[model samples]
Target: MNHSVDIVLPWVDEKEPGWRQRRIEYDQGKEIESTNIRFQCWDNLHLWFRSIEKCMPWINRIFLITCGHVPDFLNLDNPKLRFVRHDEYIPKEYLPTFNSNTIEMNIHRIKDLSENFILFSDDVFPLLPIEEEYYFKDDMVGDEAVENIISTGSFTKGLHEQRYAQVNNMFIINKYFKKREVQKKDWNKWYCEDYGDRLDRTRACVYWYDFPGFYDPHMANAMKKSTLARLWELEPDALDAGSRNKFRGASDVTQYLIRYWQICTGDFVPRRTQGKVFFPTIDTYKDVVDAINNKAYQMISFNENCTPDEFEIMKRDINASLEKLFPERSSFEK
Candidate 1:
């Protein structure tokens, strides 16, 4: 089966304009540029779009979650893209509580869509190619990670307890597994203090951290649809509650899920290392591109002394580091 991936771009309309322009100027140490805060917001969105374009070859579906003002170009004729507005999925009472309503909309979308798919945030761009083996692993869930999350009582303490929920950023879920049953089995009761004994008897496959941090940390997290469907079956009205109130921002759900996994599973997943490159802050996109071409990592700090030749050496070093880390995949000829 072809693995479907969901790219979630949750955005708000209130950000400062020309923020991107200013960021470029700040990075380049250029003269005072126009501070049209509204422009910055759009520019950032544009950048996100560019990043998405770069990742499109590997992804299957792109879900744009927004409160208001979706770019018309996106909605006009993209077959692979779907625009989900906040008002369409979220309840009226729970709307105002969230800083960005798109997150709630995303959750609702995930719940409604029966297909199994991988989810991603727009801020995160895939820098390297993804192999099929990374996603379809025999042991997607780590036992040690789950045990760590359980030990922390994530289900019984703090915001998790207050909201009676656990959140995750990227996870695999399908409609076949009866996750509702697992949710109803006391383990879902975030407020309950005695969940330890009950959890030991359950068969929940959850990994606390992203496995093989080498690629994308969000890539391998999976939950069978059967698992989530079971949870919903157990608590028919579980999604009806205003669960967003207990957290600070849109990422709370995923963050909580990570913590839950950690508490339940003691093993911490290591983040992958890619060769680091420097990003220069320049007044114009061309300057930024030039800096990248030259391999200037310190230019982001506005280092005027950096010469073009020095930047070249930096690029060579970065390539060398990549070669060391990924000898087999390294493109540099010996």
Candidate 2:
């Protein structure tokens, strides 16, 4: 709370009347699933804010970045909440975009945003009590880089929106921090060596093999406003190419670009965690419920490919579990 940090979430309502027409135009003969137009919100805003109220009370403010629509149930009068329209921060040309990568590229434009903040997806929620320091230690971002990757199966062979954006993340990191050999000891040594200093070159703190990896973008992600702004200035062409993506394109870069940038520059702490991850399915649903009941993991996420019906079921079950776990209403709610 003393750090003056805020939470930033990028949300969209696929049910918006104008959104469907815009999606058709942006599809450009490509399937919506393949084009990263599949990002949808199932009205999880209510519970998400509840989790924040129960877990992280020290948060300074919450910025809800949207295309145009705001949830009907949202407490717009709450002084702690701010609604940011895409047209407000992003350029006029990038309007009506379906690409989250493009939107993330321009998040730094949010007016009165704090220098240090945490980015959350509408689907990403806190399962247990978390503190502001969990994201920012001494006002610096908390992150880790991973090198040894297990068999994460292949994504769509062609131009998958998320996978392609990850590749761009690696490209941008390499621009600032050239590849270097990081021994097993380097990871541990970094904790004691320099937690506050900036490295002249890339360090072994972040994980990478053929491509650089961060703590994991699917979970709660901490970021710096200045770092992203600096990245735009330093890599204008890269940012330009990504921002121009009106739809999910192969050239889009992941938000991890800033995480890796901080790690390679020696301005981050390596805090890797194995939280409960529930893929979309009836079975994974049970796993998450058990994880929550047993208090096995402090964090949980439902990230997987699913049918429309399955998505609805998953959202319903997940919300039920969340309501059961944290039954109290948050002040942010009406």
Write down the TM-score of every candidate: 0.44, 0.85
Report the C-alpha lDDT of model 1 over 195-238, residue by residue, as the tens digit.
Answer: 34333433333332222111112232433334333333543343
| C-alpha positional error of residue 39 in candidate 1 after TM-score superposition, expressed in Å | 14
For each of the candidates, give the backbone clash count: 53, 3
Residue 121 shift from truth in candidate 2, angstroms? 0.7
Query: Where is model 2 poorest over a 10-residue stretch in terms of lDDT?
Result: 193-202
Off by over 4 Å in 2: 31-37, 148-161, 179-217
Give the 10-residue window scoring lowest on summed lDDT in candidate 1. Answer: 208-217
| Decoy 2 TM-score against native | 0.85
